[model samples]
Target: MTLNVANCQRCGKVYLKNMYGMCGNCIKEIDLQYDKCLKYLREFRSCSITELSEATGVSHQLITKFIREGRISIKGNPNMTYDCEVCGTAIRENTMCEPCRSKLAKETNQMHEDENRKKLREAQENHNTFKIQDRLKDRF
Candidate 1:
């Protein structure tokens, strides 16, 4: 039987394909980094995201991913505020700030409304064109 395999996204080494898509070595390294970050957080309790990254030797992006994935939580630590993904504003929870999120929501709704209007107009135009048979001409 053939086996599933893929190159690790991090180190580019061939590995058995898994859900995470990373090789075992890279996964272990990330796990270690996570442990270090958790330990530091437990001890410090109030470090910013930059500080956590510096202490744990992990990238800010990975830490943000961990927070987004619910692996890291900032609820108890007020100093762990990170920048909003959409804007540079500092945010307490989630990636995007409230304003950015609301703006995106509004834009999405407007797009959907426009699409619906276009569809309705197209349907009306199609329905307006009808084939009328000339019964008198047919008889002639």
Candidate 2:
């Protein structure tokens, strides 16, 4: 087996024979993301998967796992909401991160606006066609 030797990212300590390439302290730092997620949830009373993902930079899948395994929950409600950990913005049903929440909102809004504009353009084009047909009919 090739023994892993690497320097700890947090403390800059060089560890020999480390299999994960990170020292114990660095591993703890990695674990801290979960703590951050928990703390964020606690302070906000609830958080969506997207919000947690945004705040902790953790993947939504991992946050979903935490929720599924009963590692997290809302204070009073069995059904939890996802919100921004920093800004407390409500997130999507499955997303826990705030940034993702805002992004989703913006995208949704843009899609709606684009759809409306397309409809209006199509209506105007149809109206113009009808007007042209009327003018041609008059000539005949």
Candidate 3:
């Protein structure tokens, strides 16, 4: 394991970087909030993210992070839904919905293909230029 020195993202305090980007104090506080959220969800299993945030005094952003990390799941609940990061489609888990994921995958593959084609074209042009220069030198 490598130890890295970095400033805590949450509190801006200098500390050793761990798996979590936050400092120890912030991590502890987040853990406490997680516990509270878990306890609340146990009682009200179908609450939306906003409702949970309001009830537990935790921020919606934090709750969304917890959900994305698989620490919390609100599956099969019609009232609870999160927007996909790419297309704003409602999703039950992860950052993107299935359609968006597929679309993004296709787009990424196309981008790679385009970049490869561009490099190939440039290489061919450079080779042609070199060949022309060699022919001119022979004539001289």
Candidate 4:
């Protein structure tokens, strides 16, 4: 197995890095916090993100991360609002709001279309350019 080593963001300890950018100890701590938050939610049911974080001592960012991961949902409970990554607009399900997602999709499509057009133009130019020597028969 390949070892990817890095420093833990929470404890500042040197260790093999994982996807969360934190070491195992910190990850466990976060898991415990997630459990705490979940328990609190089950009891409070209607608590807002602020209240949840305040009660559980978990950071707002972590709770948002959990929401983004689809572990926690705010469907009917309007109190829990996941914000848009770009504009911080309250979103329900996804990481981004609908408007932001649409805008991003359009921009991405436009960039790809522009790139393809440039390539096609270059290809046409290369194929259309003719040298006078080509019109004449070879000496052989």
Candidate 5:
């Protein structure tokens, strides 16, 4: 695999880019925060993400990232909800709500169909051009 040198998004330090965008130091700090948040949640199982963030001094954004990564689970908690990434609808799990997902699926299918039609038209045009060239060659 190729490694690219990039400035860390968190600390602005130069480092070899891997799976994460942050430098080693920032990654270590985030790991520490994750551990702290996990411990706090284990002790206070009923706490919401915002409450856990306040109690542990971690950001709610990081807690949401943890939830999305499946590092933390907010199961059985109706109060713990996240907005869909595509739509503003409240969702219990995943990035997108069901309606948004269905809409995107239909759009994707339509796009594929349009692309296939374009390719077919190009192929037919090429075939007609080849046929014309063959007819000209026979006359010569």
Candidate 6:
């Protein structure tokens, strides 16, 4: 009897079992959309997140995240200009993996809280100043 082996469509690698119709390596490769990126890369040679997004029909933020993870190959020189894959936040350089995603969420929440606190502080100060002005006006 002949053993049946599944092959990945993207990479043509043989796999014992199909994982969503693709082998593990091919899945990883396809996840980056490298082929789609290559077409744009060939046309532009170099592109920022926005430019690639418009050219490839992929979101700018997503492209940026892929670049940051080193998923998208550079034709000439390498540069860090990716976004947070999970949240679409622009990051200088880093993978938008689980840990980084968690950290970003925490920081974003903290920023919102800080902004709220600042608004409260400003309102309180304004109230106090108005009360003092009223008292001074009554005395004068």
Cα deviation at 118, candidate 6, in Å, is 32
Candidate 6 residue lDDT tens string, 38-106 = 677877765666677777776665565556557675436244255555775545555575677788899
After the best TM-score superposition of candidate 5, give how far the Cα of residue 66 lies from its true spot, in angstroms: 1.1
* Residue-wise C-alpha lDDT for candidate 3, range 40-134, written one tens digit per residue: 88888878878988999999888888888888777744567777988887778778999988889999999999999999999988874456678
Per-residue lDDT tens digits for candidate 4, residues 1-103, read 9668999998999888779899899999989999998899888888999999999999999999888787777774668886789899977776788889999
- RMSD, candidate 6, Å: 13.5
Ranking by TM-score: 1, 4, 3, 5, 6, 2
Instruction: Please state the error at residue 15 of candidate 6 in Å.
Output: 15
* Candidate topping lDDT: 1
Q: Model 3, clash count?
A: 0
**Winner on TM-score (5 vs 6):** 5
Each candidate's number of clashing pairs is: 0, 14, 0, 0, 0, 3
> For every candidate structure, what is the RMSD over all alpha carbons to the true structure, in angstroms?
4.3, 10.9, 5.5, 4.4, 5.1, 13.5
CA shift of 117, model 4, Å = 2.2
What does candidate 1 score on TM?
Answer: 0.85
lDDT, each prediction: 0.89, 0.67, 0.86, 0.87, 0.85, 0.68
Q: Against the correct fold, how does model 4 do in TM-score? A: 0.77
lDDT of 1 by residue, 22-103 (tens): 9999999999888888899999988999999988889998888788888888998889877898888988887799999999
Instruction: State every prediction's TM-score relative to the real structure.
Output: 0.85, 0.35, 0.73, 0.77, 0.70, 0.35
Best by TM-score: 1
What is candidate 3's CA lDDT for residue 108?
Answer: 100
What TM-score does candidate 6 get on C-alpha atoms? 0.35
lDDT tens digits by residue: candidate 5, 18-37: 68999999999999999998
